[model samples]
Target: MNKQQTETMQNTLAQNKNLLQNEQTLVNKQVGLNINKNSENLDDLLEFVKKETQTFKDISARGSSYVSIVKSENGTRFVINKATNEKLGYPTEIYIGYKDEHLMIFNAEGMAVNKLTVRQTKNKITIYNTKLVDEIINHFGIDFSEITSKSFAEGYFENKGREILYVKLL
Candidate 1:
């Protein structure tokens, strides 16, 4: 191979290594978050996140790093960092379980009043809850609808080393 091509390959490898390292740092932070497993605290946590997002508007921007709290259908709660332009992947259900349905949207102010519509393809699961999504948009008072479930799933898969939380059964 030409010297130029070899240099280009080396550069690409270095970039990938950097991305992997950044992702690993994010994963470690996520794993270290202290989230309460009890359902009762869900509201409090949701409220705190809502308030934090509002208070830290600049930090909450899309391009900025922020914390994302997610609770799956099986009631597992975890906090992850929203890094870069990439959306995080689907919750651990896709890998840890074989069924799809029932993803609960938690709102501290008791505002997630909607039904979930689950759509599953070979490697992805998209859950759409219009009311819930709307509530989130309204709660955060921002237009983040562009970040769809599909995008999150894509992001999740692309960032291979990131941790995916699977909530323990109560």
Candidate 2:
């Protein structure tokens, strides 16, 4: 090709490359929007599942207590580990929490209490084996109620003259 024509062609190719890059950026942004939507939906489902549920823990770890809470308006900028001044869940605004490994379930007001267990008014479901119940409920990728209890091994033992229940989660 002539030198002038070659220069013109190179310029055209460079412009096309720039155009392609811009198009790719736009596509990436579109994908980001879709991802945000799906993440919100997943968070909604997680909230529904965890609502009004109680967790039980054996606190031999000498850890403190923690409570994670989501605010009403924003889905990002959550206050995680507030007692430790640690802020997390910033982008989605979901509530995250950390305790000092003391092993306990908490209520909305943040106490070592299970607000929903029928048999555990004493803050421990050691007798009725709610550990197994919670483990079964937390299983992923299947209908929790449909899973046979034999899928997991449930165990029992005595602790300080009290029955302690144990289960292998997942």
Candidate 3:
């Protein structure tokens, strides 16, 4: 072959090789993205299954001392029913204050005489004083399982119609 023709053929081959490598890289990247997308879809499906299968907790207390324990795919929380605006019979804002590792419960009027607190772990809920828990359960008619069967546990008291306060014992 002529020298010029040989050089031209070499350049064409090199360009083809470069193009093929670039295409391969793109294909590999697309494969990786597909795998990640599949895993993300699987994660979403798993969460949906968990939420559908799990049962939320509902506990009723007596004399404006109702509590609802709720859990979802996201997390768990305790709700005080009587603290709602409907139960309050007026518009009020709940205030929270921290004192000696206990949460001071208050409303628009003033601080409550009986301070309530809760200690929750991954599987258990413990009130600062068992007596308070018992009083709520006995006098106020609060009903809750001694041990939670779910992945997370929570307990709280209602401050206002929409204000649920939690105590920090940790």
Q: Each model's C-alpha lDDT?
A: 0.36, 0.33, 0.42
TM-score of each: 0.22, 0.20, 0.21
Query: What digit string (tens of lDDT, one per residue) describes model 2 on residues 71-132?
Result: 12222111113222222111111111222311222222222433332222223212133443
- Which run of 10 residues does model 1 get worst, by summed lDDT? 149-158
1-170 in candidate 1: lDDT tens per residue? Answer: 99999999999999999999788778656745444546434555545554654432232344232223233344322232333212324332222221122122221122233423333344233334445444443443433445322111111121224433322111
37-137: candidate 3 lDDT, tens digit per residue: 33524444435444644433433224333333333343345443444323433223334344443343444445554434433333233223334434333
The 10-residue segment with the lowest total lDDT in model 3: 147-156
Pitting candidate 2 against candidate 3, the one with the higher lDDT is: 3
Clashes of each: 1, 6, 4
Model 2 CA deviation exceeding 4 Å by range:
33-170
